[model samples]
Target: MLEGVFMSFGAIAASYFTLAGGGGSSQYANAVLADNPLAFYQFDETSGTTMADSSGNGNDGIYSAGVTVGSYAITTGPGRSAGFSNDIGGTTDYRATVPYGSWMNTNELTVAFTCFLEPMGYFRLLASRYGEPGTDWSWFVYGASGTLRFHWRSSGGTNTNIDTGFTPVRGTKYYVAAYVNASESGIRVYDATGLVGQATGAGGTVNSSSRPLTLMNAATGNYTANGHLDDVVVLGSALSTARLDTLAGIALTPQPKWINRTAGVSARNGTTSHAVSFIPTSAGSLLVAVISTPAASSAVTAGWTKRVAAHGTYTECAVYTRSASAGDATIQLSVSISNVPLHYTVYEFPVGSSWHSSVSVMDDNVYPVLTGLPGSSPVTVFACVSDRRLLADTAGESVAWRYFWRTELSQETLYGGGTDGIFTGIGVIDEVYDTAVDVDAMDSHVETNGSGSPNRVVFAINVA
Candidate 1:
């Protein structure tokens, strides 16, 4: 016979018990899918049964929240024990009290929990804030301390008690639930095995006087008791035993969705400087840009710009690899967005000279309003290298209109004969002469000894 006030599952495997006054291991007493998240705790004092005494270290005690934390403590008589046992042939005394707060209404109520003791002893769960002391509006106590029987007292001098020989377990999870439903008679008791006691009809009467429920330490007096408890659930609804067990069995993981998507991918390919665009193409979301140079004289500088298009020809977005050192440099590709979720796929052949910047656009976010050419949106990417110059496209037709692109590079008059203009030659082409290199972002200040040197960067736009 477990001889404690409550039984606690000590392992950290998601499920727990609240011996004395705690909400098991999850720290949440309630669990509701919609707006209800469990919130309850168990606490105990060094020696007393009051809330203040049991409030452990940190002043918040075992059952404390940011603002609304309560104190709880466990107490026992000389012959009491708070551990597991195979049989409950001995008598065990236990008590718990909420020093503060009022259980004024049915919206928030407190349920009772107890196990068997050779099928004898009184088990009372009451709420008392005012009026006639223990006989106030809060008169819900199950008197099952001696025989397998249950009794209830309500306001307006109403009372009812029933007898059911409940075969309680010696060491197990048991519950005595009370709530304000169409019939407040759902009061039930259970052992580790199954339901040991239940009322035949609605057994609880409602009182019009609104007073929070508070437990008296002893039914004979207005004080509280110090008892051990475990596995307490303060939920919005009374979950069935099967559902509760299922929840206790399942494990939960806590990570958002987006973090799983952008975890692994090279930053040095797909035309952007170390930044790959998840571009939706006729084929799929593929890496479609290269952002490095392959010759000493010709360096591939990559940059990207976004603009909200009230009216435009086609959807456009781009990513670039940070600039690389001159000669035999190209950002390589490793994976393609195939068999994955994408917004839309459109057809656009790669165009423009490898030296001249051009944008091969694709649809992202697939908004219905973006079906025409007028719907454009913008997003920002970082600069791989500052001081690298950019030149406007020589293709002056409306098809060559470059959108307003911004770079993080500081705007200073070029010194050291460094003019801010395009240095072309490392033009992208379908032919051979292959050499691709992935240059990681080289912090300009770090590589240049605090001397800001020009680094290769890419800035491109779609020219339809």
Candidate 2:
């Protein structure tokens, strides 16, 4: 048994435990979650007419016009999402209205959210403050081409519009943020990879209005959104591009005493390679964990190997690597096995941090366990790759996996599925990443088929 206070995973189905110490908080929680915004709606309630404000502000929202709580993609984590499907000519519409507050009466402001657009034939409003053309502000999709559009009226009765120029595809989730200041305004659109489209303009000052904030539709119930939305945030001041990118789940800026995780998966056959890059703001050691499916017919003799030339001085485990590099590091895995799947994760740790890793072969119940290092704040990341032989026998296998990552100040649990033996399922199945606050120990259980066939499991514990 590990010594220290144990934190529960809570609502996360994954079985994992952490030992607490030093009481250091997370950098991300401090930067993003603790920024003291005017209002923030996680949209995670199971059943409620009122959407609670997570920013500790008293600006609660009321559901209206048939807005329903629904499930979103795993990318938004385990939570309920707001669902909206507007009828072009019919009265069927939905929205959430938050009463007017001081935060809504600022010239310098920012609005951001994660939205899944279905793209109907007519114009659809994703969010707005009022319906008046020359006096209101709104973010919407162009009916003709589905381009993301932002419109805000200035104090002088002049209306400014910004376009992303890139049309949103139906049934895809996008992270969008729009801001307006006295001199300039802009809109940024991001997908899983990174920034996709952006537009900026100068000479526009936002005007204050008496209208309440409306989400997923116009205040007049016109042009309603036809999809899902979550993680709505409203700030009184404009945020930097780096901070916005971090909130959009792209990348986090590395700082002293900070931890960040980056992960991805590939199933290309015949001696292929997959790589991800990260630049540390300061010099430090990094903990890297990788899991790959074994050879199709036999156990993996020589598994994935990290390129020392590309990464740096590294210590390799069965499927994990610990690298000590300065400046920039590129985590590359060269796979020689044919027709197999590969998954890799690279975790960047700031100075004064250390990490340890462990690996296990899968059984009916697989637990990738790592003993905690003294004086290290521990956060655990686990990745499990299903055996290729088990997939060859089953035509359409749906594998369910759950994993959790927590920093001292916050924790996030995500669940996903994949087909066959390929860990290409939703969310973080093939690639797992997470960071935790002052933790002393780490362990987790991953349940798979009872068939004696073995899968590859990798675990890493980072102390800062």
Candidate 3:
């Protein structure tokens, strides 16, 4: 029987569940939540003259002229996107502007979004801040060439122009990111396959002006956008290449349901068990569980299980387990090994919108039964735990692990770092694997440490 179980909880008024130790506040978590953006427009509203800022930054955009919200061109999960068309009668058409603030004064900034452009003869602005002609910052695409561009200039005439050399195809969806730092800036353009073009420019300071940020058109309405725009995000800092790549890879649809949780176990000399319990406020949520075991513990021997209630039967899910050697032993619903710490993760789907019981073991390898709801529906919620024993020779050594879950289509796009016994505690490092996709196909690479030391890692996802 399992013994010495501990439970802790961190509550947020929001509907989504978050991990302990303030996991929701991390930068990586912020990216996943798409929270705290200087300005973020999901364009998910059905009808409204005002474009709500989902970032909670209060920098809302007010629609003007005949700008309308329409169905998203690619993914309907996000519902709708802001539409823009040129009006020859001198009307401004569709555009939005956020009031000016100090947060807009950063020397570094990142502008990212998904867009589908229609063919046109002139330049079209995606987003911009207008100042007197010689002093402006804008991100736009050349309508004829489809080249992504970022132009910034100071009143003194010092300026920079960064552009992607490759042209995007008209009428196709594309992800674009522009990064601007004090003396340099760059642009990354991505399509369905992967990265298309990247270019950087050096020189000139990133000028800050009092102009309000505008979307889909310039302040004067000269360069109007002729396309569909969705999932727009504007950040105060210039993000790294890897983060940009991550933003480009994931599905742009905002997840309707999700949660995250984590647990840690200290090393013990003999067989000991630890478990984390997560009770979803919503019934029938899908659950994705991940467990990381540090090398300090003795090899796990498949002695773990999850139960919906204290005495409920265990449910099945797709389980993938790995061990250091081929000689590891196996147990029912678990794996057994000696002298090698291990990691385990599971993806459990809901049954017709209903949740079931679950159980887990701390072994080197796992072959969990793959049974649950299909991927067509969104996951409602999930819980996870890590249980293990310390090596007799490695008693008192620390053993730690963490896991999290998100709805389908909410998978993480990028992950870095390898399994080399480097165990950074939750939220300490920027690299995190919180998405279900990380476990489904083992999409991210994991490197093993040859030493008998512990190799552990926690994976969590941030939901918006």
Candidate 4:
């Protein structure tokens, strides 16, 4: 591939389950429940306030007046399912509570739910057992931002969060789940499309044993869900990726992740060079690079293959990649050049992944977008502009996306006696992405440097 190679490119309620229509309950016979969830509440009740636990463990939930028991909504499951509609501020705020018990397992845990999100501009509580900051467990969608936030800690603040790169909306019905396996140090998350995100995990937490499992809204009354909740589940142990995929009702091949990235400092043709360094991100990770230059030079390190490039009139950009052997070995990038090869950056993609698709050009792009993305892979864009006083940023940024480095090249006066800049980044978009929903727009800079309208070479890469 010459010009383009790579390129390019929740929440929920408490824990409840509804199998469309009257007979929908049978769907729970799925392998998900085989893991023996601590308490499984199948909300089949269209009357009274009781949401029964069918896991043979009997931990039931009661509803508040604000909850309409027999409401309806369509789901990824069969039939038109029965749901619980929280009248945002109708009478009382929506609330559901299941008695707390020894079910709290801080070592490994899982929580799953299906909900209809509304466009309210507040916090929509999903499941909460939060009391104090250090030991609290809060999972919900910030109604204002629609970001699915998860907080799982061991004690004090020694924990972190897992982010599902995609955001949810009102029109779609989604099945969401979070699995925390402290032993594996993995927190896998699923939405309508199987395992969408995963992070180094956090252990579960043993509650005060006094707080009831809050569904839809927190006990402190600080936050409440503003939509409909159809199915929710809690497991004492983390569910495997296959089981979690089954729960989401979607078949997705978990894609590779963007592990690490490195960029060198500014250099003039005869003056400077950078020795960029990065260790193998994983046992079998692959390292790749995009070199932008005015012309070909012997500036590249050995053992790297040029995967793709766009040779423009004034400048050009190329992609180079190499396999990383399993282990803690570090790869080095040393360079020597004459006029241009303006900059180069190295990156590591998840093990067993390869170049999928991309888009690139050796010219100025005021409005650039990366399309033809592989459904479940991550994409990263890199750009090098002639003007050094540059600012690199994403046109459509989000929680799932990450920026690696934005370096300013102050010494170069190549091609146009101009300063230069470069910015490159990626996303854990390795989720089963709905390309129709996610945008891959790339921009060179927010504003031009005071001295130039320089040309630039921009490219996007996808790894699967």
Candidate 5:
């Protein structure tokens, strides 16, 4: 009997947690993806003027020749950020232009950038638009004043200014942003610290831009900033100071997927402790292993705690769990006997998930009756169990399994299956769920058949 909150019957993770394109770890992309931006430019290019939009929205951008950039190189920020130097020769000949499709003509729009500047001693435009004289909006740190400003020209030819009192300095990296919405105030400007300035007169948005939206200059060469920019994103809706902070200092690193596609989510078998091979990327990640050894008692590794231990067909089955550390490449454990076949499935719980409870079945129960859950919020319950040999549902809690997937391996042979059995085997059955269903829709237990041989390893994870 352990002291804990909720109860769980499973754990799962794989491509389900995959971040943006493979070029960067989803660690950072995941956060950015949460906001659902229309176009996200990581500036991960070397020679070509093409700026790949990582948002998957296909709103790619083209850079000007004056801007010299390279593949991702900077790493001192959020994730992996490409580094580049802007040399827009004091002219209106350099800028990054992105398509302003009909979807962009929104009343609510936000544009943000994280950049490091080299003293330019002149006007520097961060982002803006170029069109008819009466229809233009631009934000820049004006020369001399060095104040961050947000301005917009409404389609009605009305001009408004939102002077974000905060000033940016040369030789310093800063996260700068501007928000404009006709439904709200004038315009809001922000720095990494927070909302520095806003007003109530700017009532225009992307609708005023005739050409593509431009960065580092007003789509022309005017006031082009000389610096490195990253985390450049454009949103379809306006965001408050709290929500807009998410874009600050976001980094992007192109690396191999945390877990590859081929063999990360399935089951593996071995005769030794060092059975599974996985390289976790950070701390606080939950690593779980469910081991079933044929007629042998398996032991948990040094750093892992056994969550549930049960027996079936004289076979030892247990669930081992451990949080991630700095370096946990290949997990190792041992059993009483070396020659016995040990079948196990290793799963990395979704990132940022908290464990609830885990249970293994010795009788007819596959999961526990979840009640008295402590939180007002909902949690994810995941489960997997080999039911090749499940005892009869004489326990009354027995119900049909509704959310499980069949596996290819035959790990549990019911005792009544006419083999080296202690009870009557039921049939060859494997079940698990990789995705989520309504939490209340889960059953308390499962039934094979009355008087049927029941023996298997089952486990679940509840994450809040």
Candidate 6:
């Protein structure tokens, strides 16, 4: 029995089982209980709040309407979910007390949930004990996986995995159960099938007698899980194999696929080479296009592929471009169905190189203008000029003479060069405006116009 003395007799007040019609506060009446059982109140991005009564009076306090005999206290935060609660000192602002004072080394605790494969990333389902402000103890950290892996750790911060065993297949449901006990702490993953695999053999803090733990979807500024979570449950005591099976049988709450892709990406192209990259806003196969204004040298299509790698949470990709010459290029990334290889094209110049003078309407439209060079093969450097002009620095007075090619040309090429005082390329009288001139193609080449190398090269690419 709970610890509380009775004062008045039993009286049934108008219980608010159903949420008031029209509208109320953010709190909602999930169930109607004759006596208000102690509940953990949280209001953040993961778990939002709901109103109880229709007057919007249900702010963030412990209120007892049905039973007027004994009273319970609560800890309330102004805006978001505050720390834990002990109910001591009348719910002013105290941390939550750990159950049984502390954890028993022999005892155990486990949490289980269902997730999807939409937002491939990390999540945190913690067994935390709240105390003073900023003083919180977390037991486990786990979530969805793809190109990367997302798992949790104990007090020692050991990596404990929490995957569905089977690969994360979108539109499909999978269950992940993280177990923390005295014998050992491990994870058992399951897809639509029964049991996939068990990754036991990890050490963690044993919060046997911990406070009410919460399911936290935490992201460390990386890929986020885009999946649904349902049927969240906590075993009152250490769960056994039989108990785990029973709990898994129960229905769970459902969450939507998390879209964790960032806003955009930045990349560049190189002389006689093209660069590539893409930003995903959701979980789906995309088609990437690689195009050059005059077409690439080898007419080779770059192959691109993405998969769950790091931490098994986010998607990582790899693309390859064939040997090509100087040209204006762009890569367009698009999505298609699963199992189908990611579509991408390589746009290279047909005969000569092209240089972009100023920021044009196609500035952002061009994909591989400033892309990094590949490490495998050396790219022949070329620059297109309106009048076959020599590259010059911004000052124009500092005439560059010697050229230094890209040194950090591991993944991409970085070239610079030109002559300063006696320049004849820019004023070449009969030269065509769009003439492709092959410069020095080496590991690292510098463009010089004066005593030093050319300042910078201006280039343009077409998306169409």
The number of the candidate with the highest TM-score is: 2
Model 2: how far is 150 from its true place, Å?
Answer: 1.0
lDDT (0 to 1) per candidate: 0.27, 0.47, 0.42, 0.47, 0.47, 0.27
Of 1 and 3, the candidate ranking higher by TM-score = 3
lDDT of 1 by residue, 1-464 (tens): 21111222110111111234322222122332221323232332323333332112221212212111221211111111121111000111223333323222333333443322222244533323333444544434434543333344454456545555554433233454443323453455653344556653343444434443333223233322122243333443445544433333221111110101111223222232232233222221112232211111212233321111111121112232221222312232222221111111111222321122322212211111111111121111122221222232232111010001111122221111211221111111111111211112111111221122233332222221
Q: Residue by residue across 104-144, what tens digits does model 4's lDDT show?
A: 53456678765555554455566666543334453333334
For model 6 the local lDDT of residue 38 reads: 28
Instruction: Sort every candidate by TM-score, greatest first.
Output: 2, 3, 5, 4, 1, 6
Could you give candidate 2's per-residue lDDT for residues 1-464 as a string of tens digits?
11111212112111111101011123322344566788876654434677777677778987663443422112312111221111122233446778777678776778877665555455666666867555555333232256887777777777777778878765345678888777788888876556788888664556777778877566676665555455677887888767787776621111222356555555554454555465555655655444443332212223223322111011111344455456555655554444345544445555655445444444323333334422222233444434343333533333333212211111111111222233311112111222321111222223333334434444444434
> For model 3, how does the per-residue alpha-carbon lDDT over 114-219 read when each residue is reduced to its tens digit?
7655554456666778634644553333333556777766434566777676666553456778877766688888765577888898734457777777776677
Q: What tens-digit string does per-residue lDDT give for candidate 6 at 1-464?
A: 11111111111011111110111111111211111212222211111232122122222322122211111101111121111111111111211112322322223455554443343343322223222223133444343444223243455434455444445544334455656665566666554334555566454455332333322221111111232333233332345555444333321111101111111222222233333443333222222222212111112234432211111011112222222322323343332112111212222322222222211111111111223332121222222111111233232321111111111110111112321111111100011112232222211122333322111222222111
Clashes of each: 71, 7, 22, 17, 29, 96
What are the models' TM-scores?
0.32, 0.50, 0.46, 0.44, 0.44, 0.29
Q: Which stretches of candidate 5 lie over 4 Å from their true place?
A: 1-23, 71-90, 118-123, 131-144, 186-206, 249-464
**What does each candidate score in C-alpha RMSD?**
25.4, 14.0, 15.7, 14.6, 20.8, 23.8
Q: Residue 391 of candidate 1: its Cα lDDT?
A: 32
What lDDT does model 5 reach?
0.47
Model 2 clashes, total count: 7
> CA lDDT of 254 in candidate 3?
29
lDDT of 5 by residue, 198-258 (tens): 5454455434455667776665455655555556677777766555554442331112212
What global local distance difference test value does model 2 have? Answer: 0.47
Ten contiguous residues minimizing lDDT sum, candidate 4: 1-10
